[model samples]
Target: MLIATTFSSIASAADETVTGIELSYDSWDYNTSTSSLEVFIDDDAVIVSLLAATSSSSTKKDVSASATWKSSNTSYVKVDKGVLTAVGKGTATISATYGGYTQNIKVTSDYVYDSVQILKNGSNAAESYDVSLGAEQVFTLSGIKSGASNENITTNATWTSSSSSVATVDDGTVTLVGVGTTTITAKYKGKSDTVKLVVTSPYKSLALSPKTLLEIDMGDDDQTIQAIATTTSGSTETVTAKATWTTSSAAVATVEDGVVTPVATGQTKITATYLGVSSTIDVVVRTPYQSIKLSPAKEYQMMLNSPGLQITAEVQELSGNDENVTTQAEWTSSNLLVATVTNGLVTPKAVGTTKITASIKGISRSIDITVFPSVTELTIDKESIDTFPEKSETLPKVSGNTFGGDTADVSKIVKWTVADEKIATIKDGKWTADAVGKTVVTAELNGLKATFELNVHLTPVKLVPSTKELSVVIGKDLALPTITVVNQDGSEEDVSSKATWKASSDNAIVVNGKVKGLEASKVTLTATYLNKTTTVKAYVEEEIEKLVAEPSSLELYPGKSKSVKVTGYYVSGKKVVLSSKMNWTVSSSTLATVNGSTVKALAVGSGKLTGSYQGKTLEIPITVSPKLKSLTLSDKSLKLSPGASYSLKLQANYTTGNPVDVTTSAAWVTNKASVATVSNGKIIALSKGSATIKATFDGKTVSMRVTVK
Candidate 1:
């Protein structure tokens, strides 16, 4: 019989009775009292556990084998015997019933494939892939599920690339487009994955020989260049024959393959491109010469019908080497009538100066050529000379006159001889008088001759003074008359040094070729040379009665100076300058300092200077003004071009005076002579730069900035 009995007879068995069902999962939190659970799934399936809680025991018993599990939606989640599997991406309820108790668990299913992976080559997983430029790569996509084998989803997935220019992907195939980085992605059923892709160029950099600049001479042989590229693997390869070559200007230079040929004298750019990398070099096609020079660097002299002079031309190459091009140079003459040149050979035709030039290519050098006519006449500077015995005299200089009216000194070239050796002897253009006799000398040059007469042991017959009468001021000296002697040969000789002098009056005396006046009186002086004698009269002037200074007054700034003039008036209405003979005195030494007749203002003050000559005195009033108040320039700043000149006016102002123009007198200086040069307040711009010009006058200085453009 089926009978229900509420019996507490088995108390021990009742204490172990199941009270509620508990659900747990390693990835989710389950509540025993709440009777529900929620779980997040990253994989397709997971193991779930069920437990039974006893009323009298704290420990729970595993009831997974005894529990029955059910899924709300078969497409979202499915469960069987405490095991749950995710079918799709959605949320579903999983329930377990044990011991008459049921627990509902919420399960959110992700994509059936937990992750998408990219496989390279043959099933090898890769996070990043590298492909060559203009190349292709095949990538495979796979689905990954937890606790399950990975599945190939390459065909069923949508493939995309981050940058199509760098890489393009279709299905599982990836094509490299450029040399950059891009991301490759595959998406399937809400599951997406990515892989970094780098499409690289085979070459890292391209380099060309003569990397900086290539210089070639026009009409010279072509230059061969080599192009090399560095690979991504840190290896070098030669690509000279494979590089595409181009030039900026074909007229200047042209390149084919790796050969560079100069076309004209100009500049161009040569570029070499290999794959996606390029390199360029500047090319210059110009003359190979730096400068040209000609032998016989200075002016040359030649005569008509003379042998032609061969001039040599030297060209300084760009490599700092010199080359001789005498025969290759083209020679020209400015005046063909004077001289003619052919291949650096100069031939004179007439007597004149001509400019001769030797040129090679475009460089040239010039020299002046002077053609002279044949010498026709010869002469000496002195034809006759009188001297005593045992005295030596240098022979006269010899001169040659050309037929073309040109004169030249031919002293060293002329041949000189003496006719009478006993009377005189000649050697090295010098003549020695040996005896009391006369001799004849001859000089010859270029078929022309000249004669020089020499007289020895000549006696003086009479003495004549240069002056017969003279006047001397009192307490002053006058130069004595120059004494001359008439020789026996009728030649005059100056014997002032050997003559004896005497004064007739005691008031005037001769000393050191000068006549000194001690008193105011007329005196007579005599000079004798050997047996000849001469006389002269000297008159002394009286003392002055009054003295006067020129200018009378002075106005000067400190550090400035002026000169004073003193004139004495005699009793006979005669006046003489006594500036040097006067005794000077200043009223204030602190205000001014006097040096002879010049007075320099020392400080700002007023003073008077006195000059006493004999018994007469002159006074000059001087006022030393303050230092220069200011200095102003017409332009404080200037802007000018090269080779431009501008006149600047500098005006100086003082404490008590009119403005003075110090443009021409001020001291001028330029800080930068290369940029601008200043002289006397005039500025000249030299080049493009800046400079400062300063002007100083009367202890004051002012400056102006200049810009040369």
Candidate 2:
């Protein structure tokens, strides 16, 4: 009998289970209930035959897969009839069920390919291409794998054109049909690449419309032309700007971007050429005007009731032909009371200006005539004065011919006015500069105005600083607050240390560029310069009293040393290490000595080691043991034969009554080295004689006699 059982366990965040199936041929989690499959684009389909089984008699056997295949998100990964395919880069839940048994396999698809390169005309394309309109190129798509070989995926990729109207692509074939630009994209799974294409028409021949061009006006505006380009297929298009255009004579006319401009009155040919085909058009360049104008002397100045000056005028034709029509033209003045024009002569009757109109061939143009004063002259006490806005000066005491002719002050009659009120204000013969710049000031009298430019600038202003607050630790110096100086032109400058400083309370003080904390209180720190003052708050903290040198007592061996540490405790229960800054001293130099907080043992004695810092002192008792009270030889006398050697042994006895071997370290001497020589704790017998051996260590010595027989 065939039986079905379901068993599951919580795997990671969610519960995924496997039942009634044998899961093998995998590396991770498939047999345990939670399994997933990973694949990339263009990957082979995975056959799920492992999920199929059948029961017969007393055994289960592998059978054809009859289970239905379904996917959670078909866009990511999908399965059809037990075959799984990857569509895009994402995850999908693929489930299969048959005969009351179900199994799930999460499939993840990823885009693993790195890039795609295009192959044009059966070869790899190293760069983009430009094709003519109606041309075609067979483009095969290639998907390049990262760190691997390039793959020809033209048949497997989907091809698309960004601009369908300009070009079209089908199965990797690109066909250009219009004169435009477009990008061809090749996609394989989720990886895609694009190549830009520009389609241009094959130009054949260039032709100009009307076989002529109209003359251009003399201004910034340019006139355009019409150019038709004919192709070899007998098709014509207006490719005016696409063709290069040139004038036969630049002195007569110029052409640019299909625009032709007339430079002088003449006839010239404009030629436009494209792709080795050229066409020419004859253009007449001329100006269009109504009548004549007088040159050189547009305006004439004449005294009242006097003969005027004679002027000349020139008339041009539609063909740009000029003629002197000065004597043939009739003239008249707009203001007859001020001036009169007879033929080309203008006579002034008053101190004013008149418009003189000249007519030729019934076409009219005007000129100007002015009359000056005969003897009047204007003078001023000051022509131009350099002053600021704070000072007020009267309008120039302008007097006209003060002694010789028409002697009278004309300052009031002048009526001065400034051109720009925002720059300077003028009222009742007085002016002020509102802004820093040069302004035009005019003095007018009897329709005559004289203009003068006045320059004004702002006065320099003092510096101002932004406010700041500071907090300092007890017995510490802190940097002063930043100060900025307000410049004359209303700008700022950093002058933190340049300003004079003062404190409101004695609890804190300012010195150099820093503020010193005195007592635990608040004080006002002020910075002043050039009548400007700015204040800031200074907060000072109190001193801490918790200084501790641990292990109030210590024991050390003779000639041995230890490092002493000193730490300060704050009110907030914080510790500050001060070993390097404290002064370390021992009561007796014979017992111990300290160098940089390290106490060295000198003798077997007790002494007081003191550490002093900032009005506080610390004392600790230090004792040195094993002081080497005496050094003695184990054998005081020895008898040896000639050529016999004996090793010496020495011992040091300390004040603590401890004995130690001082053999190799003890200083040894032999009074008669010929009899017995002591070297490195060993004595050698040389000849038959008596010798004395001595050993010394730690200010103690011992002697022994050796006899060689």
Candidate 3:
């Protein structure tokens, strides 16, 4: 029975003990679970032992008494214990094992019990702020929120600012510093937000009035110019700055920043600009001038043909700011009569006084100029009353001539002095004859003197032949007579040395002062002195005489012969042989022969007769006539047979001045009709008949008979 009872007990325990539980959770909540389990217990309040069960193992779970479980109202729950405690979540099984017969229960947990809340440092807050220069600004972040939590809430958040100096935010805190705008950004949990901060200043800004400037000046290291520029607003904010520069006109001036440099002595415009505005200042450039002083400051003098004089001036340095300065020197003369300047060289043109000026830059300084005249000197060779001709006399004659001295470049008064009174006397620069001798004359002019010797000789009187009696042939020689002279003492003197002979006719006549050649029909020989000349007449007859024959004698024969006769003459009327006796000759002997003045002919030929006289000769020709003879034939009579013919030829001897005509013909009365006739001295016989053939020449006739038998 105990074994039966234990077995029965086992079966009952299985049916009553806890098995498994199911759960429905809306959220984690303990009150809903407790509430739902209470309803199944039939008591609102019960002490239940909740046992949790899993598929692997089982155990009785415990819960606090103060825990509450809640769920949806329609959900069911079973309790395995008398007391029910709410647990947070899930499903479980419960059972009671007091009696041997156990009872089982099921429990389910379906509920949500967690809550979320948000907190803030302040309700209304600012994220950014603005501050003035040198002033500080601060800002605090607010309006923080939480989704759900009963645990500690600690997380890393980030904040960033756009301009650090102007305004900045750190860990939701912001600080403002300098000017400009600032942006603050807060980042958390991959989300970000931004805020802006602006800073400004009450003070005005400063800047250079003109942003850029250009300055210009002449090319000088010391050249300076001023430039000005203005600012918009400020007391100490007005700032000035120089511009770094280069030069396009370096040959004139160079400018660097605000400084200027002059390269040469010239004018140039310098432009100085500053900022965006500019004002220009003019810089004047000056070159040092040179001062000059002329040498020989009082007067200058020179002489003609003298060496050139140099006029110079000393140049002094002047004080000034200058560049590339130079000086040129020059000179001038007021009048060339006193002096002249050629490239500063002076020469005298004449005797005078004038002013010489030295000039520079249109300003002139003057100096006096003076010139002295040259001295004059005169002298005569002789001083006395002399006899006649003097060496210093240009046209000395027997009466009395003065001797004048040569004067050149003489201007001062001259005084005359005679060394010897016997030969010549001097008045001015002239001398008068005193005696027949030589003397010296002197003249003085302003301490300068000169002397000359004078010579006086006796006058010579001349006599010459008269030209009216002179005569000469075209080509011949004649002797001229010498001119005779007499002195003042009436005594004859040899004047040939002092006399000059000339011919007053054609140049064909030549005279050598003493002798002359007769060259024309008439010529006059003249003897000349210093002022007088005498002519002499002379005659020259032709030396060669002409002779001519009144009628030349000539002879000739009837054939040809010549005879020539000539005559000649001489100045002495002497007999001369005739030209026929000198060169007369016969040309041909066949035509003619000549013997002295006679000519004879041996045959019928031409002859030439020639005669010579002086340098000329003459020729004569003669012709001779031929002897005549009557016409004749070889036979006087010609016989011809019947039916035969004959020819007759005739010849004649005739003399005529020219060729003559001769003709012949037959003159016969023949009974036979067959007989022939003759013509022009030719005969032809024909048939049987007798005829007469006759020839006539120049009206003369001759006859011959011809017969044909």
lDDT of 2 by residue, 204-300 (tens): 6677776655655433255677888888799988878777889889887899977887676577888887544678888776545445778644555
- Listed in order, each prediction's TM-score against the native is 0.25, 0.23, 0.21
What range of 10 consecutive residues in model 1 has the weakest lDDT sum?
Answer: 1-10
Runs of candidate 1 with Cα error greater than 4 angstroms are 1-209, 215-295, 313-325, 328-337, 358-365, 373-709
Residues 133-182, candidate 3: write the lDDT tens digits.
Answer: 54544333332335533331213345677778666666555555456887
Q: State the weakest 10-residue window (summed lDDT) of model 3.
A: 1-10
Between candidates 1 and 3, which one is better according to TM-score? Answer: 1
lDDT of 1 by residue, 332-399 (tens): 99999999998888999987889999876556789999876667888888878877778887788877
Q: After superposing candidate 3, which stretches have Cα over 4 Å from the reference?
A: 1-421, 438-455, 459-479, 544-709
Order the candidates by TM-score, highest first: 1, 2, 3
Highest TM-score among the candidates is held by which one? 1
lDDT of each: 0.80, 0.71, 0.47
